[model samples]
Target: MDASEINAITDWLIDGARSAPMPSQMMAQACERMVAAGLPLWRVGVFIRTLHPEIFGRNFIWRQGAPEVEVGTVDFEIQETPEFKRSPLSLVFNRGLEVRGNPDNLADVERFPFLLDLRQEGATDYVAMPLRFLDDTVHAMTLTTKQPGGFSDAQVAALRALTKPLTRITEIITLRRTATTLLDTYVGNRAGERIMGGQIRRGHTDTMQAVIWLSDLRGFTALSDRLPAETVVEILNHYFDCQVASIRAHGGEVLKFMGDGLLAVFPIDEYIGDANHVCARVLEAARESRCSVDALAFPIGEAIERFRFGVALHVGNILYGNIGGGNRLDFTCIGPAVNLAARLEKIAGRMGRTVVASEGFVRACGADWNELGEFPIAGFSTAQRVYGLADEAPVVMA
Candidate 1:
């Protein structure tokens, strides 16, 4: 690209970054502008590592005349895959290398196995540019050419010059996305928005009435001791699948995942539902989650056939917001109701029940709950009444 064309592209990208364009659109626009500037650009791709649990990274592909950029994702298992080990992206993403390949040279075969196939597909030269972020993390951008003579030294120099603004534009886009991901990953969506919306002062809280739910794996301590670490993690994830999906389906927001335990709440708002409606929502989720946990099938030789979980439901006024010390902070709920919900989980397991509801929940829900008799919770001075749900829940709980 010439000096004037480079300036124009940089201005366009910097302006686009301000408007919060998609990552793929930024890459595609850069490719379009570079080709307009007399650069023999055939394809461009970007590989950026992100902070998602399942997605290891994302890829943005820009071809000559595609309507929009074709996108793909790399799963967490990418490092162990043969496809990752064989590609030029692997060298850049793993070894932090800046790779250039010319298909005309047979010597490139040992270095890039993809060179042979790309050569047949009309690719003459390939260059991978490594972009370094302020955090010291390296990402890659691959640009390919179909020209006969490949890229001249001057053209490669110009391409290198453009990498700076290109990196800035991508980092701008990535930073926005990473913030949302980190918030969503560490905190619930509702709480994450409060944080991003500038409600970050310590002790910023909201008092509300909601149905609280707490679930715990029955034998996690013993299971962790008996199984390998990896096996234990997998089992925990499987168990969570049952709890999270059911809770979300019934309009419950998952608040936290405390080791083998899960905490969630169904907010009772005027527009969403009344107090009785909220209770029924938690009961339905409890029934579905219990069935889901029981249906988990393991291999014949596995330690256990299926996971056993105890779920407890309670309802009362609770304070939901940021709570912690100077160093560490957590956005969660805390109150006497929250403590009672946890205590009921232990009582459920001891009584051989998969689901248990406190008097507050059962009464507010107006559902027919079989009384499990009064039990003395550790912290409470007097005994409290606890109830369990039947196998089949009626159509209407209220």
Candidate 2:
């Protein structure tokens, strides 16, 4: 590779990096250009650390003649296994050193088993370089060739010359992916997009009618206190799985989790049926929640019955967006109906009901529910009416 070839690859990479929406696409183009420049690159792999709740990192692999990049994710357990310890990527990440191994050629050192496997597959050279970020943490950039002579000094120098631009391109891609992963992990997808679209102002809110869904374990405090700390966490996660799966399956976005409680919303947009579709979604979610929670019992016979929980659904206008103080904020709903939903859940057990809702929700759902009489609620100037969304017979209480 000469100076002209290197310059052309750098220019093409700089231009393509800006237009590519995905990191894999940018990498694919770069690999194709490198191979075109007479660099016998048979396979290329890059790994990046990201800010996702469940994902530790991801690997993007490009092979000759493949249309695009193939991706593999690194999870928590994968990071701890012995398989990662003996790999070139692990050495680069852990020791911040460059590694070159060629098992096919005589007199060349081959340390890891993976390199030997690559040799058997016709690879003549394997080189892994440490990709550093602004924070100084090392990721990975690797290359392999199947040519008989392997990579010449000129080819390696050309790759070394592209590091600055490579770092910039990958930095942009990783940061973009980090922003989306963090936002989607913390906030629901739609709400996260709204926030990302410049809705971070403290007073920024939209008044929209949505069905509010709030639910919590019936005896979470007692359950947590009576059980081991580890058991408590397991129980909480199990309980959340039951609610979250149901809500997401019904097109509801889980907005927040307050210890034992979960808050969600099914926003009703411009399109409206005779009865709002959001109501049925919330009802369907509630039914699924009730059934699933029933099955989330302790594996043992420690308790006479399964764990219990209650859900409250109400439809009304809400001020949804950023709200808080001291430079921190919460992107959540706030309105009279929000208060009413929580208060309804507070009395659900006393009323011998597992699921309850307001008249507005009942009307929108087009369900025959027993109406609960009006009652004075805290933080409210007047009494509020309610209705039952329970599967059982009516059991109204004060």
Candidate 3:
């Protein structure tokens, strides 16, 4: 290719890198270009194993090409420059050429059984390539063929040329998703605007007034004991889905699912509304939680008590940013206020109330609440005047 033509192709790739949401699609387009530019090829595939080993796990069909194989294949290692041994039945894992001249070895084919059937089916060639973008450790692309002879050396070179740009694009999309998920976990609300701010500085912090709600599934342990493992997971997922949807639908963020319960919050942004507004939003979430729970008719396989939820909402300043050590960090909030919310939620269970809030929350709401009385709550240094948010008259407990 001439310098001008190569420059045009490079520009097109750069533009694609900017627009594409994933590396796989971008690699497919690049491979199409390589094919158009005289590389004989029909299929293109990408594999990323950074977070999940299953991306290139054993018996993979994209590489091994055995139709009879159930699971795909994995590559523990790769050999360079040798003509790839193509098999009609072998599963290919690497990114390169699998051709007729590439002699197949029994021991190698045995290691990846997905390739066994491909050889039996009269398929002979494959090529898989590994692409690394930025600082990532497990991202690569693979190209394959069912024909007798695999792609030529020049074709492999063309495929290699597209690797860097493809990797770079993949890295960006992956990082962005990581950041967004972190923001959602900590902010406890839609943080599109807040996450946008994170792009400005690497480790800046912000304190926002937010209404935090913590709720746990009651009798979860006893319920789990009675049901089979599959039944347990199904029930938990169904319950969590219902609870989380109620929270998210009312502009609340489900921060973390703590096995049996969830933590959530509605950010009281000055630009959005006020504390009372945020509490009402949380209260709406509470009502929705009850409604959703009541609607569930899940069978526990025994005469188990119906599921119920306990919620506590508190509004205060929570310092939000990333925490933890090294690269393994979490973007979440911390402070006395978060602790208080959790404390009250626990109190709800002991006091036989579904929803409980501190006197401070009630004062912030500037509304009357059913008097549940001042009591010494565990983990709190002093007696806290708590209130019960019931559907009817307050039912006080000892």
Candidate 4:
């Protein structure tokens, strides 16, 4: 490609591609533009490291003639594998260096096993370059060519010239994605969306009806007193995982984890039909969590110790939004409904019940419930009715 063509592509990268909605789309368009400009591009790949709990990075692959780019995620565990260590992408990621391979060179093909496949596919040359972000972090991009004698020196130079513009665009996209992932990880998805949508000011709240979930690990104080700190933490993590996985799978979002206690909500939307379905889903989640907690066992010295927890579900209106002092704020929910759920959870521990629901929940869920009778709840003037799962027997604490 000539200097003019390269300049056009750089302009597109800065102006058009930078505003693309997704990284994958940007990559595909970039490659398409390069190929259209008479660059001998056969396949293009962009790899960018990101901040996430489970994902290490993401890769966007655009093969010539394909309608769309193939996007894939690399997990943290993959970095420890022998395959990743031996791959060219790893060298670019770890060493911050450019890698070049010729399909005709046996040593290059052997050193990078991926080259062998490229050679078989009629590829003649491959080049991987470092994409240095504003923070000096190194990412990578690879280009392959099937042209007769591979990319010319001029073509390679033009591609090199484009890296600076590409790096700026990629960093812009990566930073936005990182911000979103961090928010989603720290808060629930729905809350994260609200924060991103500018609902970040203190006292910014919206009243909404939801099925509230409050749970506490039974006998946690005594267990922590007996077990080592690390052991206690490990057990708490495993125990919370049991509930979190089930809750998320059943359309609930975990709002907070306080010591061995957890709070979550399943939002109710009038537009989405009746509250019965949402209540039923919360019940299913509670049942699954109960079974998981029952099967949970941890090794303590020579014997295994079983675990138990109490959950209280209530359906009512909650004030959902940000509330805190100064710059430090917490995006969560509050209301009388939350207070009642908390009280019901404490009552569950005293009653040795695994799961309990408020009268509102029991009525909405339409489930066969064992009426547990009215009991005086703290901070409330009247006694509140509670119900337990008809099929669940009171847990026998060891």
Query: Largest TM-score belongs to which candidate?
Result: 4
lDDT of 4 by residue, 53-156 (tens): 88989989999989899999988998899888888888898899989999889898789888888989999999999999988899999999999989899889
Every candidate's lDDT? 0.84, 0.81, 0.62, 0.91
Q: In candidate 3, which residue ranges exceed 4 Å CA deviation?
A: 1-3, 11-206, 228-230, 270-273, 302-305, 322-330, 366-368, 378-382, 393-398
Write model 3 residue lDDT over 107-204, tens digit each, in one string: 65655444555566554544555555555354545455555565556556665676666666656765765565545544544444455565234355
| TM-score list, all predictions | 0.80, 0.88, 0.56, 0.97
> Total backbone clashes of model 3?
41
The segments of candidate 2 whose C-alpha lies over 4 angstroms from its true place after superposition are 11-16, 105-110, 228-231, 272-275, 299-305, 372-385, 393-398
Candidate of highest lDDT: 4
Model 1 worst lDDT run, 10 consecutive residues: 389-398
Candidates 2 and 4 compared by TM-score, better number:
4
Candidate ranking (lDDT, best to worst): 4, 1, 2, 3
Cα misplacement distance, residue 355 of candidate 2 (Å): 1.6
Model 3, TM vs. native: 0.56
Candidate 1 at 3: error in angstroms? 2.3
Looking at model 4, report the run of 10 residues with the lowest lDDT sum. Answer: 16-25
Quick one: ranking by TM-score, best first? 4, 2, 1, 3
Report how far residue 355 has shifted in candidate 3, in Å: 1.5
* Alpha-carbon RMSD, candidate 1: 4.9
* Model 1: per-residue Cα lDDT over 1-398, one tens digit each: 57799788878776764543677767777888899998888988888888898899888989988888989988889888876787788888777788899887888866777788889989999999888887878899998899888988888888888888888878877888889878977787778888888877779999888889998988788878877898888888888998898888888889899999999988888565598987888888888887888899765364555777888899888899888899478899999889999999888877778888999888888877798899988888889899987653322211
- Candidate 4: clashing residue pairs, number: 0
Clashing residue pairs in candidate 4 are none
lDDT of 4: 0.91
